[model samples]
Target: WDSVIDGNTSMEQFLNIALINAPLEKDYTILGQVLGNLQQAKNYLDLMAPMHASYNSKISKALSQMSLRMSMESYRNRDFQRRWFDAYISLSSHGEALKHIQSLLQSKSHIKGLSIDQDLRWAMIRQLNRYDYGDAQALLAQEKHLDQSDSGEKAAIAAEAIRPQSALKRQWLNTIENNDTMPFSKIRIAMFNLYPAEQKLLSAATAEQRFANLPLMDDKGPVFMRSFAAALIPTQCSAGNINAISDVLDTQTGLSQLARRALLETRQEEQRCVKIKLLLQ
Candidate 1:
C-alpha cells in the first residue's frame, strides 16, 4: 500500500488487486493506507465497510481519531478538510461523532481559532444541535466571537437564531429586517436565514426573477444562485417551477456537482411536500 501511495505501483492496478486480496483487519495499517491517499479512500472504505462494521468499539475509536488527525493536516485546504470530516463523521454514530468534533473545536491548543471556516463551524453547530440541543446552545454561548461583519458570519448567525430551539429567533429576524438594502450576496445570506415558516413568505416567481437578474459576469453570481436554490427548498414552490429553476441552474458555468446535487434534492423535497399536502387534504 505504501509503495502504491508513493507512486511506485500503478494506483488502478493496486486498487484492482486490493479489491480481491485486501485483508479485513481492524488495524492502523488499513487506516493509514486509506488516509494517505484521498483518491482511493472512498473506494477502499466501500470495500471495507462490511468487515469494518464488525470491529469492536476500541478500533472504531482509534480510526475516528486517525481521521481527525488527517483532517487537521489538510487544514490549509478548507474544502478538502471539510470533506474529510464529513466523510469521517458519516461513518460513526452522530452523538459520538459530534461529541468528538465539539471537543476538537473547543481545544484551542490543537486547532488555531482563525483556521476554522464559518461554514464548517456552522455545520458542526447544526450537527451538535441534532444530537444535543442544550450542548449546542452552550457552544454558541461560548463561541460568541464567531460574530463578524462578514456575510458568512451573518448567515451563520441567522441560521442558528432561526433554529426551532433557538432562544433569539425574534431578535435575529429583526436584525435581518432592519438591513433591507443589503447587496445580492448578503441577500443570498439572508435568504438562508429564513426558517421553514418564514420560507413560506417567499414567492417562487420572485426567487426566479431575482436569480435571473444576477450578473453572471460577477464571480459570486453562481455561488449566490446555488444558495438561492437551497433557500428556496422550504418555500411554497411548485415542483414544476422548481424544475424550471433547476434547468436555469444547469446552464450556469462553473457550478459544482455538489451544488447541482443540492438543487436536485431541493426539487425532490418540494415534490414530496406537494404529495404530503395533497394526501392531507
Candidate 2:
C-alpha cells in the first residue's frame, strides 16, 4: 500500500506483487495508482536531463528498454486469452481462434491501430476457411484483389492487410462449444489443404493452354494468350513453380499435410518399382 501511493516503487515490482497477491491474499485495489505512477515516471524520464551528452543517450536507451518491457508484459496478458481460443479449437474440433479473430475484425474498436502481423493474418484466414466470419471474408477478398493489382512490397502488404473471418467462423465456434456434433472439422481441413495447390495448378495450366491456343485460333488468340500469361502467371506462384507448390504443401491444414505425405510416399514407391523392374530386366 505504501509503495503504491509513494510513487517510488518501480512499475514492475508493483505489477509483480499485484499479480501474485491481488484479490487473493489482499484486496488489491491499486491498479489506478500503479498506472498513474507509470505515467508520471514516463513524463519525468521524458523531461529529465543527464549531466553528459553520452549519459543522455544512455538514459534514452534505458527508457526505451523500459517501455519495451512494459509492452511485452501487456502482450503476455493478452496472449493468455488467445491461447484459450486456440485450445478451444484444438480440443473441440471447431475454429474458435478464427471466430475470435473475426469478432475482433468486426469490432473496429478491437482492430483499430492493431497492425495485424502477416503470419498471424494468414493463420487467421486459413482458420476462417474452416469456419465462418462473413466480414472477414469480404475484407480478405478485397485484400486479394488489391494484392493482385499491386506490385512489389506494396502488393505483399496489401495481401497481408485482409484476413479470413467469415459467417462460417461462428458456426465452427458454436460446434466447438457444443462438443462438435456437426463434424465439419474434417471437411474444413480437407478443403483448406487441397485448394491452394489446385488453384495454382489451374492457373498455370490455363495460362499455358491459353498461350498454346493463341497460335491456333484466329480472333486475336495470340495477343490474348500472351497478355493472359503476362498478367496471370506471376501471381500463381510466390517463388518459382516448385517453390510455390512446396509452399502450398507446407502451409496446408493437417489433413492436407497427411494427403501430401501420402502422395509423396506413393511417388517414392513408384520410383522403387521402376528401379526394381530395371534391375530384373
List CA RMSD, all candidates: 12.4, 23.4
Write candidate 2's Cα lDDT for 1-281 as tens digits: 35433434443454446434422322123533433443433222222222123433443344333333333334434443233223222112123434555664445325222345544444545445433344545656655564453232332332222222233333332232233343333323322232122133333443333223322322323433233222222122122433443443455433233344443443443343233223222
Q: List the residue pairs that clash in candidate 1.
A: none
Task: Note the Cα lDDT for every prediction shown.
Answer: 0.48, 0.35
Top-scoring candidate (TM-score) = 1
lDDT for 5 in candidate 2 is 32
Instruction: List the candidates' TM-scores in order.
Output: 0.38, 0.25
Q: Residue 109 lDDT in model 1? A: 33
- What root-mean-square deviation over C-alphas does model 1 reach? 12.4
- Model 1 lDDT vs. the true structure? 0.48
